[model samples]
Target chain A: MSNATQPTAKPDERVKEISAFRNALIRPELGGIVGTVAVFTFFLLFAFDSGMFNSQGIMNWSVVSAQFMIIAVGACLLMIAGEFDLSVGSMIGFAGMMIAIFSVTYGWPVWAAIIVTFVLCTAIGALNGWIVIRTGLPSFIVTLAFLFILRGFTIFLPQVIERKTIIGGILDVAEGDWLAPVFGGTIFKGLFVWLGEAGLIATFERGTKQGQPVVDGIPMLIIWAIALIIFGHVLLTKTKFGNWIFAAGGDAEAARNSGVPVNRVKILMFMFTAFCATVFAVCQVMEFGSAGADRGLLKEFEAIIAVVIGGALLTGGYGSVLGAALGALIFGVVQQGLFFAGVESSLFRVFLGVILLGAVILNTYIRRIITGER
Target chain B: MTGNSKFHHGDPKGAVQPIIEMKNIEKHFGRVIALAGVSFDVKPGECHCLLGDNGAGKSTFIKTMSGVHQPTAGEIFFEGKPMHFDDPRDAISAGIATVHQHLAMIPLMSVSRNFFMGNEPTRKVAGISFFDKKRADEVTMEEMRKMGINLRGPDQAVGTLSGGERQTVAIARAVHFGAKILILDEPTSALGVRQTSNVLATIDRVRKQGIGVVFISHNVRHALAVGDRFTVLNRGQTLGTAARGEISPEELQDLMAGGQELAQLEGSLGGTV
Candidate 1:
C-alpha cells in the first residue's frame, strides 16, 4: 500500500481561513447590516440641511425608530423560523382594546387589565398556532384571516362595552408608575434636581439642565422592545428549541428523521409571533392612551419589511433579531429623514418600495456568492 | 485455483454465521409488491455488497433495514435476536446508521452543529438554556480525526464541503455514535475517481473497527474492490451469494447483470445463427 497522504499544515490553515471568511460572508444578517448602514448614510447625506439634520432631529428619529425596532425584532424571529404572521397588527389592536375596555370602561384595576389583556392575547396566539398546525394551511392565509377578524372584533367589541369609537384607560398603564421606571422612566430630571442645585450639576448635566432632561420619559414600549429583542435573540440562537426552529425551517423531513418534533416547533414559532403582537398592542395602548381599530393597521407590513430588510431570507432558515432592529432603524430614519429633507411625505411609500426590492436583490446575490453558486 | 484451500486460509467461506439476518422479509405499497420474501445476512467485520438494477427491490430492502419501512412479513435479527423497529430513530438507537446517496444533512447548518444536532451538548444556568458550542466543536473535530478527515473548520457549512467529505462526516458520525452496522447506500455513486477512493478508504477504516458494513452499489468493480461477501437481488429475490474468492469481478458483474437471463435475451435477439 502507498503512504497515506496527510494534508499539509500550511494549505490546511489556508483552507480553514478561507472557510471562516466564507462563513462570515454568508451569515444571513451581514447583508442587512450593510443595507441598513448604506441606507442610513444615504439619508444622512441627503438631509444635509443643518437646520433639520441636527442632534435634536437625530434624537427624534431614534425615538420613532425604537418602536419599529421592537416589532421588527419579533418579526425577524418569526421569519427566521420560516413562517409569517399577518395577525400581529390585529393582535396589537385587540390587545390594546382589551386593556382599554377593561381598565377604563369596566373600571378594572390597571394591573388586572394588563394581566387580562396578555392572557387573551396569548390565547389568540395559541389559537392561530392550533389552526395552522391542524389544517396545515399557509400562515399567510391564516394570519390574513385573523387580521380582518380581529379588526372587526376590535371595532364591534368597543361598541358593546361603551358605544364609543375609542376605548380608554390604556394610556395610564403606558404612563403608570409601576411600569414607568422600567419602561417609561424620565431621563436627566428631578431625580438629579438636588445635584443640579449643588455644584455637581455641571458634571452630571453636560448636555441638559437640572442634571436631567424632562423628556417624555422613556416610553414603556421602548423598554419592552429592548427586553424582547434580547429574550428573542437568546431563544433563537442558544437553545435546543432554537436548533429545532432552524431544522424545521431548513428541512422539516431531515429534522423529523433526526427526532425533532417538527409540528411542535412550528406551533411554538407561530405562538411566539402572536405573543410579540400582543405585547406591542399593550405598549401602543399605553402610549396612545386609547385603543382604536385603526391603531395597528398596516403595521404588519412594516414589521415584515423590517424583518426582510434585516437580512431574513423570504425562503427562511436564516435571520437575526439584531438585524431586524437595524432594519427598523433604517426604516425609521428613512421615513423621518424624507420629511426633514423637504420630500413630500406622500412619496415615502415609493422610497420604501425601492429599498425593499433592492434589499431582496442584494440578499439573493450575497447568498449565491457565499454558496459559490454565482 | 485450489478447491477448499481457497476456502480455508484468507479464502472464501459461505459457512460463517451471519451477524445481521433478515428472514422472509416482505413489503407492499398498497397493491404493489416492493419486496417479497427477500432474505440476506451481513457477517461481522465483513463488507457485504448488495447489487441490483433499478426497481429490483434494492431501495425497499435498504429502507426496511434502516427502519424507513416496517416489513409486512418476517423478522430482522441482530446477533440472532429478532428486532422490531418503528422508525429511523429506533434503528439508530439499535446501532444501524444509514449514509444515504442523496445526503441527509441540513445544508445551512454548521458541520459541528449538524454533527451533534439531535444530541446537543447544553448548559443550563438560572433557568436559561445555552448550547455548549465549544465542547461540540471539539468532539466533532475529534471524530473527524478518527476518520482521517481534516475539515477546514467546525463552523464550515456542510453544504460547502466536497461530496466525499460530506460522506466522511456522515460515516464518522455513525462510528462516533456506536453504529456497529453501517449501511451505506451508493456512497460513491456521485463521486469522481479520487473521491470514490477516499470513500472506499473510509469504508475500509470502518471495517477495520470490526463493524459489519452493508455497501450497496451499482458499480460491480467498486463493489468487488471493497466487498468481502456479495449478494445479488433481481425482481425482489436474491439471485445468488458468493464469497470474494469464489467469484471474480467479471463474474460478479455478469451475475449483477442477470447472467443467464441476459444471455437468453441476446440469443432471442439473434436471427437463427
Candidate 2:
C-alpha cells in the first residue's frame, strides 16, 4: 500500500512488499466497514418500506447508536491502553441514581447533582485505575469487582433515601436548569421546523403539536457521540500521546524503557471511560426524566462487543475509534432494523454473537498478516 | 577481523578525554556482589567491548552504567563532570543511550512510530500539537538508509524487519537523539552471521560519528570485529583492558573464560570431565 505512492524509481529489494490489495485488507477498520455496509444493506432491502429509513426512524436508531458510540469510544481507548472497565454499566446506573437522589430526594439543584455525579464517578474511575496499577492485578478482575459494588450501591441508595428503587420527576426539577439542556435538549429546532414547513419531513397531523416535525431536532446524545468520536480519532492518530497509548498497550515494558508513562496513560484512560459512562447516564436520565436501578444493564458488555466488532484486538494495542463507532452504528441499526423488519427482537443477541465471532476471526487474520505470523 | 588493520593501539583519536568514565564502580544486590571495583572508560569514536562469560557480572555492570541500577559505590564522570542518574530517563537526557538485546520497540507499531516512540516530533497547528509524521517518516527512512537498511516504507511494522535491521533502527535512534555514549548489551548474541555483520558495521558507523560505544558481548569474534579496545570481566572484577591489536582473539577468549578458574577446573577434572 505504501509502495505505490513512493516516487523512488527503485524500490527496496529487501522489503518483501505485500500487494496493495492485501495491504488494504489488513486495515483494522476493514471488518467494521464490511459489517456496517452489510447490515445497512440488509436493513435497506428488507425494512425499506417499513419506514426504517424515514426521518423519525433514522433519528430513533441514530440516538440508540449514539449511546453505544459514546461508551464504545471510552471502552475502545481503555482497551487499547490494555485495560478493561467492567464497571461501565454499573457506573452508569450509579451515576444516574446519584443525580436523582441529589436533585429529587435531597432537593439539590439539577446542575449541582449532575456535576457532582460526574466528579464522583470520575473519582471512582481513578480509584479503579489506581488499584489496578498499584496492586498489579488484572484490570478485568478489579473492574468486575467494582461492577457489583457500584450496582449494589445504585439499588441500595435509592431505596434507602426514597423508599423505592426508582426515582422520577427529574424533569420537573430540571425544567429550567441551565445545564439540563445540554444533555437532554435538542439542536436545530428552527431547521427542523423549516424542514417540516418545506415538506422535507413528516409532521404531526391531528394533535396540538400539529405542523411540527415528527423528529423535533437532533439529540444532544448524538452530538456528544460525534464529538467524542472525532476527538478520539484525532487523539489516537495525530498526537504524540496517541502514539504513547499504542505503545503502552502493545508492550508496557518496552514503552517504559522508551520513556512513555504507561501507568499514567492507563489511569487516564480508565477515568475517561468513567467520564463517558457518566455522560451516558446523565443523558439517559435527562431524556427519560427518571432514574432506575436497572438502567444501563449489560451495557458494559455491549460497549466491549461494539469495540471488538469494530476490529479492536482483545489483547489491546491495535484498534481504531472510528471502527468502534461504526460497530456501535451497526448495533443500533440491527437492533432497530429487527423491529422494523418485524423479526423476533430476541434474535439480536444471536446476531451480536455471530458478528462478534466473525469480526474476531477477521481481525486475527489481519493481525497475522501484519505480524507475518501464521 | 578484516578491519583490524584500520585501527591502531593508542590512536590519536583515542587520546582524547573519555566521554564517559567509571571509576571503582561497585554494585551489590543484598549479599551478592554483582560488580566490584570495575573501572572502564570509552573515548569519543571508540568501540570499547566488555567481554565476559555467563554470570560474570557483565549484565549488572552495564545495567549500572545504563542507570537501570545505581552503583553501590562509584564515581561516574561525563565530560569530566560528576553525575547522578535517578532513572533511565535521566541518563537518556544526558545523552547516554543503551540498546538492550531485546530492543525497546513495539513490534506491532509502524517503523516511524517505533522510531520516534518517546521523543516524538510535533508541529503546532492552530495551537494544537500534532505529531509531525512527515518529518518522522522522512527521518526514519534517511537514518535507516544511512545504516544501509532500505526499508519498504516507514509504515512497515517493526516486527516484520530482520533482527539486524531492528538493531540498526535502535542504533540510529540513539544516535539521532544525540547519544554521546551508546551502550549495546548482547546485540549480536541471537543474530545469524550475516545479521551480526550488519550490526557490527552499524556499530562501526556509529563510532565513526564520534559517539562512544560500550559493546557488551561474550562472543569473542564479534567483539574483535568492531572493538577498538577490549575489557574482560571475570567474577565481578575486571581482568584487564587491552587495545584492539594489543590483544589477540585467543587471549581475549581465555581471559573471558576465566583463565585461572579454567586451569583450576582442569587440574581437578583432568581437563575434560
Provide the lowest-lDDT 10-residue window in model 2 chain A.
A1-10
Candidate 1 TM-score, true structure as reference: 0.86
TM-score of each: 0.86, 0.94
Reported per model, the fraction of native interface contacts reproduced equals 0.25, 0.51
lDDT by residue (B156-219, candidate 2, tens digit) is 9888877877888999999999999999999999999777877888888888899999999999
**Candidate 1 lDDT over residue span A256-317, tens digit each:** 66677877887777777777777777666655677886788888899999888877787777
Give the per-residue lDDT of model 2 (tens digit) for A237-318: 9999999999989999889888899999999999999999999999999999999999999999999999999888898889
DockQ of predictions, in order shown = 0.35, 0.42
Each model's lDDT: 0.75, 0.90
Among all windows of 10 consecutive residues in model 2 chain B, the one with the lowest summed lDDT is: B1-10
CA-only RMSD, every prediction: 5.0, 4.6
Which regions of candidate 2 are displaced past 4 Å? A1-15, B1-14, B260-273
